[model samples]
Target: MNKITYGRQTISQDDIDEVVKALKSAAITQGEYVPAFENALKEYTGAKYAVAVSSGTAALHTVYAALGLKENDEIITCPNTFAATSNAALYLNAKPKFADINEENFLIDENKINKLITENTKIITPVHYAGLPCNMEEINRTAKSCNIKIVEDACHALGSSYNGSKIGNCIYSDGAVFSFHPVKHITTAEGGAVLTNDEEIYKKCLLFRSHGMEKVNFKHMPDSPTYHEMQFLGYNYRMTDIQAALGISQLKKIESFVKRRLEIADIYYNAFKGSSKIKMQKRYKDRLNSHHLFSVVFESNDLRDKVYYYLKENNIFTQIHYMPVNKHPYYENLGYNYKDTPLAYDFYRRELSLPVYPLLTDDEVYFVIEKINTVLKAL
Candidate 1:
């Protein structure tokens, strides 16, 4: 039997040709492809500015740094997310607070957010879990009332929309971040980007991604005529030309990729419709998701584990999207207790991610559904 993988990159020869062209170009690291990619991303997401970086974590760190989070300042985000979501704050010596997510949507609830706010809360970083857009209108209103910055951790929602606006527009937030990992809606081998309409934040991200070096045209610099200066400490978070060349190609196919994933998701949605063993993540009627991961919440943790192992035994690969960050050893030591985010902890116990991607076939979808049903029946 052929082993079916959970998620894999769908790369074409066109992607390779672009990377090859970049490899042969003179300025492979600092070339037209990088700017071209940034422009393409800017146009797609309707953001005025974007800064491409090496990885999603790097993008998160850059945006948080741009927001100027410091010690004694705090950032609030949901526990139902990858560790990188919270690690971005811990990187800045700022407190990473956990807010529980809504069980229905698996997103950080706006009402829960309002209750968690304190004078030290400097930022609200919300992850669009499973590509479902959070209630941005409410979240925005709440954040504004508290006078805190909003940074959208939109790693799973590149092509998603909320209330007719794209996810990265910064209309509801000060900044938005995206990832282009292999399993994501798009891929650049390994890359990410930060988007913002705020000029100061945009400039800060640009400088921070490239070691904070400001190349001065002798005409612009009177004090130092011959060399550039490191204005501030930064990281080498710049994405390579090879990555950008591939990204430019990948970006062109994003619409089609998203469309196909939506189709596959519909098939899975119908397959599991009215299923007694699990419940689907709720989608808001007004929002359009990219369907990055078609996740389901089993009735119980033990049933979820049985289904997971059964699927694996049948040569089908499956995965869990996350474990609540508060439960992790590192965060526990940071004084975060599980009682802090009960809803998120509850949701985390039952969630499982099945195979979902542009290349997932109908037959495979059926096999996945049939196998899951069979496993549940035995349990």
Candidate 2:
């Protein structure tokens, strides 16, 4: 059997041709394409401002700095996400406190988050895990009571929505970040962006992404007419025109990409609906999932391990969406005990992400389902 991947980027001639055109242009990095790409994303997500950056980690780091996180200042986030979501705060010498996740959707539990808030809590970073929106309404309510800032870690959610609104609208948060990695709903080769309506946060992220230098000339600066000033500490996190060009092209197809993913997810959902050994994540009908991943929970840790290895041996790629961040070696060294977030730790051991992407064919989907059924039968 041929090897099938759990996630992959679907690129086309349009993406290639756009990159070629960018390469031939006189300006590549500082060209008009960068702004054009930012505008395209803003239009798609309805955010007033968007700052494209080199990588998702850079986007998160920029937002963390923009929020004015200081040493020992704490940010609360879920454990069911990639490390970048929480490590962004750690990069600034700030603390990343863990909040348990709802076992149903694998998102930060609003009630758990409410209990974790303290005077040190500066921001509430919620991850829309597996393209499902978090309990944004409740999260927003709780954050308001505590006067904490909100920065959505929307890496897995490009076309997802909550309460009839888009994820990047910043309606319930101060800012939102999206990753354009190959496996994401859209691809920019390797890029990310931060979206916000607040002018201060937008300007902060824009300056922070590019070495804290304001390239646009300001009449207030007395030194020189065209000279730039490095006002704040920053990093080289700017995205190139090549990546921007690809991103613009990819954005045009996001809706179709999301549509196909949802279709595939439906197939998987129906296939395992009545299975005794597996259970599907609960999705609310009011919101539409981008279907970035199709995860299933097994009956036990032993069953999950057996099924995962069996699929791998059969050339069907399978993976765990995450291993609770608090349980990681580094976090463990920080004195984070596994007993703190019992629900999160329990979910992590049995959750599995199966193949679900826009590029996966119908035949391949059937093969994956068949193989899974076979493995379950034997077990």
Candidate 3:
């Protein structure tokens, strides 16, 4: 009966206890909790190395830099993701070429990638949109054949899996990124990480995360204990120990969080299964969705908008996953066209994210389903 949001964090008393301990610790930033959090992530995702950062965007930017993306280099990705996915590449002065999404799954169509590959194409960023794993195995094959790198924009897929492997394992990618924003599956208040198997990439990300300065790998002065070198330009994208402490606690509950999300998604799917006016995202046998959001695609844009307003009026706060990233005013000014990815634009028009957080009670879940069905029947 109260206001229900599409996504939110569920922080336990245990999480608060950890944060309290972190606050009282001597080192809050650049401390033990940071590596502890990274280790937790590595253990969860099966990644050999994990580099925690200030935000998801920073994770992407650091990984892009690590992969040697530079001026005029191109990275192909889907248009249906948050701008951070492509904007990270832009930070390195590299161009982003978008391949359209497959209408069934709302993921990049791997078959469409070859046409976008240029001599300068450096990386293929596959976004696992709405917590559904993209076809990374196929994408990996394409990247290998083209001699390109793969950095998964897995901000929506922290607990998701593909071909029985966890999403951030980096089995099919050079590196994978995960977000720890409040709305994500896990929360560190505001944090993210880069998961990779390559030691060189891991070291580069570590350097990039802290102003490109290293105390050990000093090019100029190796003997002096105080001496450090700024190997290249980098950002101050370090996650604080307090945030890392929160993350460690949250990571422990990820399995339960993702399970609850999937249960909610299944309820929505079954409720709308026979509805002619509403459509659910296609599920694949090979991939496991983390269910960051439970999105429904309506028969028409008008109906989708009507349902959104109706839900809002009934105290349900739904959201749109995204407008096509290329359609934003900033991207438009840069000559990026939304129409180029017609499916993405169409998806944007019809999609509405329903409340699916772990804390959302079953009663609230049924209320959302009932309200949506009621709206459709009225129309």
Candidate 4:
């Protein structure tokens, strides 16, 4: 029996040809293709600048470093997401505070953010969970009044829109990050980019990714002109040209990829519409969910586990989007426990992500639906 992966990359012959062509070129690491890919992303998201990095976590760290987060500064974020969302703040020695999510969509609750804010709060990092954009309009207003910087963890939101504006447009937030992992909307094997409309942020992000050094320029033609200067402490987080080549090729089909994901999500939604066995996340009419992961919430944790194992027994793989960050041992040792974020834990307990990718066929989709229904009937 062929194993059905929970999520996988959809690669074509075109993608391979692009990689081979890049390898045949002179520069495979830092080269022309890197900047070209960044420019492409900038235009696609309507952001003034895009800085590509090694991974999504690297992108998040670059943004925090650009913001100058320090030990005394504090940042607020939701707990119902990947640890990278909060761990980035910790990298700066800045405190990571939790703001519980809304039960409906598992997104950061705008109303609850203010109460968590304090004098030390320097940043507000909002994660657009499951490719569904957060209420940026309200979140922006809150950040402005408090004089806190806004950084969106939009790792799952490529090609998604809120109120007719792209997620990385920087309309509501100061900046946003996108991940191009194999399982994301598009893949560059392992890459990410930071999008921003602010010029200062763009320069800082660039410098932070490349050893805090900038190439110095001289008008006079010297015999050998290779000059560079180190500005501040930074990291080697630069994305390679080979990965950027794949990124440019994959980007061309992003709209079609997201469209297919949405079509799959809709099928699952209609299939489980009025059942007491499971509940789907509510998609706001104004927001277009990119459908990075089509997760369903069971009535109880026990039922969620039963369905998960039953599907696994039949060679179908499923996963949980996340466990509450506060529940992790690292966070727990720091005094963050289940009691700290009630709603996040409740949401985590019922979570069950289904298989939804561009390459997932209708036959496979129907098989999943049938197996799920069978489990529900048996229970």
TM-score per candidate, chains pooled: 0.97, 0.97, 0.99, 0.97
Report, for every candidate in turn, its global Cα lDDT versus the true structure.
0.89, 0.90, 0.93, 0.91
Whole-model alpha-carbon lDDT for candidate 1: 0.89
Ten residues in sequence with the least summed lDDT for candidate 1: 217-226
Give candidate 3's TM-score: 0.99
In model 1, what lDDT does residue 300 have?
Answer: 95
The alpha-carbon deviation from the true structure for residue 357 of candidate 4, after best TM-score superposition, in angstroms, is 0.3
How many backbone clashes can be found in candidate 2? 0
Candidate 1 lDDT tens digits, 1-379:
4677777788999999999999999988877888999999999999999999999999999999988998889999998998998898888889888888888888888788877789999999989998999988888898999899999999999999998988999899999999999999889989999999999999889889988877763335556555767887899999999999999999999999999889888988898888887899897789998888888999999988888899999999888877899999987887889877887777777888988888878888889999999987786
Estimate, for each residue in 231-264, the C-alpha lDDT of model 3 and write its tens digit: 8898899999999999999999999999999999
So what's the TM-score on candidate 4?
Answer: 0.97
Worst 10-residue lDDT window, candidate 3: 217-226
Better of 3 and 4 by TM-score: 3
Worst 10 residues of 2 by lDDT: 217-226
Model 4 C-alpha lDDT per residue in residues 226-311, reported as the tens digit of each score? 76667789999999999999999999999999999989998999999999879888889899999898978999999899889989
Q: What is the lDDT of residue 352 in candidate 3?
A: 95
| TM-score, prediction 2 | 0.97
Query: How well does candidate 1 score on lDDT at residue 273?
Result: 86
